[model samples]
Target: MKALIIGATGATGKDLVHQLLNDKDFEEVDIFVRKPIDVQNDKLKTHIVDFEKPEEWKNLVKGDVAFSCLGTTLKTAGSKEAQRKVDYDYQYEFAKAAKENNVDDYILVSAYGADPKSRIFYSKMKGELEEAVKQLHFTKITIFNPGMLERKDSDRTGEVLGSRIIKFANKIGLLESQKPLPTDILAKAMINSSKIKSNGYSNIKLGNIFCFAEKSND
Candidate 1:
C-alpha cells in the first residue's frame, strides 16, 4: 500500500517514516516536507511543498492511507496563530486533500485530552482539528491520543523534566495511564491501525495505544 505522511521531520513522524519504509506491507512511502531530507530509500518519495499553498501539492497527496503527525509547540511557533496554522490549518488541509484524492484511510496523532470544548488553547486547537477531519469522512479514521510522548534525545527542559516526573509516578504504580510513551511505540501503533480492516472512526487513547503497538500482524 502507498503511505502518505506530513510532519516527516518530527520525532514521531521520523519514526513513522522509518517504520513505514521497513514494513513489508507498505510499498510506497511519500513524505511531504518543507525541505529535502537526507534519508534515501527506493520506496521513499520526498515532495518538497509549501504548506501555505496546498493548491500546488494537494494532488500529490494521493495514497491508500494518509498519516497526519504535523504539529508545533507554542514556543517554536512564537504565537498562538502561528502554532494553530501548523497544528490545525496545515494538518486539516492535508487531511482534506487526502480525502479529495480518494484516500480511504486516515491516521492522526492527537493529544490525550483533546476535546472540541477544551479550555486550554493547545487542546482546543487539536480538538478542533479532530472535528474538522472527521467532517471529511474518510472510510476509516484512527486517532491516536497519546500523553507525554517520550521523544528521542529531547532538548526541551520542561518536557524532559515532566517525562522524568511521569516515569517516577509510573514506577510508583501511579498515573499508569499517563505514562510517557515512546515515539517509536506510537509509530508502531499507527502502522498497525492502518493494516487493520475497519470502518468508521476509532479513537486509541493513551493506555490502549500501548496495546495497539503490541498487536500481532496477520
Candidate 2:
C-alpha cells in the first residue's frame, strides 16, 4: 500500500511516517510539508508545499490511503481564523484533493467531543471537518478521537502537568479512560486500523484508542 500523509512534522504524524516506512504493508510513504526535511529514506517521498496553494501540489496527493493530521493550536496560530486556516482549510483541501485523485481509504486524527453542533469552537471546527470529509465518500474512513496526548519533549506546560496528574490518578485506578495517550501509540493505532479490511466509517474514541494501541503490540 502507498500512504500519503499531511502534517508529517507533528508528533503523531512523525511517528506515523516512521511506522509506515518500516511496515511491510506500505511500499511508499509520501509526506506533504511546507518546507523540506533532512530525513531520507528509500520509501519516503517528501513534498514541500504551500497549504494555501493546493493547486500547485494537489496532484501528488494520489495514494492508496491518506492520513490527515494537520492542525494548529490557537496559541500557535495567534487567532481563531489562523488556526482554522491550518486546522480546517488546509486539511479539507488535502482531503478534497485525495478524494479527487481516487484515494479510497482515508484515516483522520480527530478530537474527542467533536460535534458539528458543538458550542466549543475547537470541537465545532473538528466536527465540521469530519462532516465535510465524510461527504467525500471514501471507501474506508477511520477517525481517531484521542484525548490529551502525551507528546515527547513537549513544551506545553499544561499538557505536561495534565499528563502527570492523569498518570497519578491512573496509578490509583482512577480516570483510566482519560489516561493521556502517547503520540506514538496513536500513530500505531492509525496504521493498524488501515490494515483492517473494514468498510464504512469507524470512530475510534478515547478508551477505544487505548484498545487499538494495545493491539499494535500484538
Candidate 3:
C-alpha cells in the first residue's frame, strides 16, 4: 500500500514515517513538508511544498492511505488564527485533496476532549476539523484522540511538566485513563487502524488507542 503523510517532521509523524519505511505492508511512503528532512529510504518520497498554496500540490495527494498529523500550539503559532491555519486549515486542505484524489483510508491524530461544541478553543478547532473531514465522505476514516502525549525528547516546558504529573498520578493508580501516550505507539495504532477492513468511521479514544497500538499488527 502507498502511504501519504503530512507533518512528517513532528514527533508522531517522525515515528509514523519510520514505522512505515520499515513495515513490509507499505510499498511507498510519501511525506509532504515545508522543507526536506534528513531521512532517506527507498520507499520514501518527500514533497517540499507550501501548505498555504495547496493548488500547486493538491494533485499529489494520491495514495492508499492519507495520514494527517499536522498541528500547532498557541504558544508556537502566536495567535489563534495562526494556530487554526496549521491545525485546521492545513489538515483540512490535505484531507480534501486526498478525498478528491480517491484515497479511501484517512487517519487523523486528534486530541482527546475534542467536540464540535467544545467551549475550549483547541478542542473546538479539532472538533471542527473532524466534522469537516466527515463531510468529505471518505470510504474509511479513523480518528485518534490521545491525551497528554509523551513525545520523545519534547522540549516544551508545559508538556514536560504535565507528562511528569500524569506519570505520577498513574503510579498512584489515579487518572489511568489520562495516562500519557507515547508518540511511537500512537503512530503504530494509526497504521494498524488503516489495515482494518471496516467501512465508515472509527473514533479511537485514549484507552482504546493503547489497545489498538498494542494489537496493531495482529
Candidate 4:
C-alpha cells in the first residue's frame, strides 16, 4: 500500500513513519513536512511543503491512505489563533486535499476529550477539525483518541510529569480506561486499523487502541 503522512516529524508521526517504511505491506511512504526528516529509506519519500500555502502541495497529497497526526501546543504556538491554524486549519486543509485526490482511507490522531461543543479551546479545535474531516466523506475514516502519550526520549516537562502520574494511577487500576499509552503502541494501532476491512467512520478511544495494538502483535 502507498501511504501519505502529514506531521511526520511529531512523536507519534515519527514512530508511524518508521513503521510504515519498514513494513513489507507498505510499498511507498510519502511524508509532507515543513522540514526534512533525518531518516532515509528506499520506500520513503519526503515532500517539504509550506503548510500556510495549501495550493502548492494539494496535488501531492494523493495516496492510498493518509495519516493525519499534525498538531501544535498552544504554549509553543504563542497564541490561540496560531494554535488554531496548526491544529485545525492546516490539518483540515490537508484532509480536504487528500479527499479531493481520492485518498479513500484516512486515519487521524485525535485527543481524548475532543468535542465540537467543547468549552476548552484545544479540544474545541480538535473537535472542529474532526467534524470538518467527517464532512469530506472519505470511504474509511478512523479517529484514534489517545488520553496521554508516553513519548520516547521526550523533553517536554509537563508531558513527562503527566505520563508518570497516569502510569502510577494505572498500576493501582485507577483510570484504567484512560491509561497513558506509549507513542509506539498508538502508532501500531493506527496502522493496524487501516488494514482492517471496515466501512464508514469509526472512533477508537485509548482503551480500544491498546487492545488493537496488542491484538496486532498476537
| Counted clashes in each candidate structure | 0, 0, 0, 0
How does candidate 2 fare on TM-score? 0.92
TM-score list, all predictions: 0.93, 0.92, 0.93, 0.92
lDDT of 4 by residue, 1-218 (tens): 99999989999999999999888989999999999999979999999999999999999999899999998888889999999998999999999999899988888888888889999988888888888887887877787777888889989899999888878988998888777788898898888988987644344444635221111111
Q: Residue 89 error for model 3, in Å? A: 0.3
- Candidate 3, residues 1-218, lDDT tens digits: the string is 99999999999999999999999999999999999999989999999999999999999999999999998899999999999999999999999999899998888888887888999999999899988887887877777888888899999999999989989999999988888889998898888888888633344454635211211211
Residue runs of model 4 more than 4 Å from their true location after superposition: 200-218
Better candidate by TM-score, 2 or 3: 3
> For all the candidates, what are their Cα RMSDs to the real structure?
4.2, 4.7, 4.2, 4.7
Which candidate comes out best when scored by lDDT? 3
> Where is model 3 more than 4 Å wrong at Cα?
200-218
* Model 2: ten consecutive residues of lowest lDDT: 209-218
Ten residues in a row with the worst lDDT in model 1? 209-218
* Per-candidate local distance difference test: 0.87, 0.85, 0.87, 0.84
Clash pairs, candidate 1, are: none
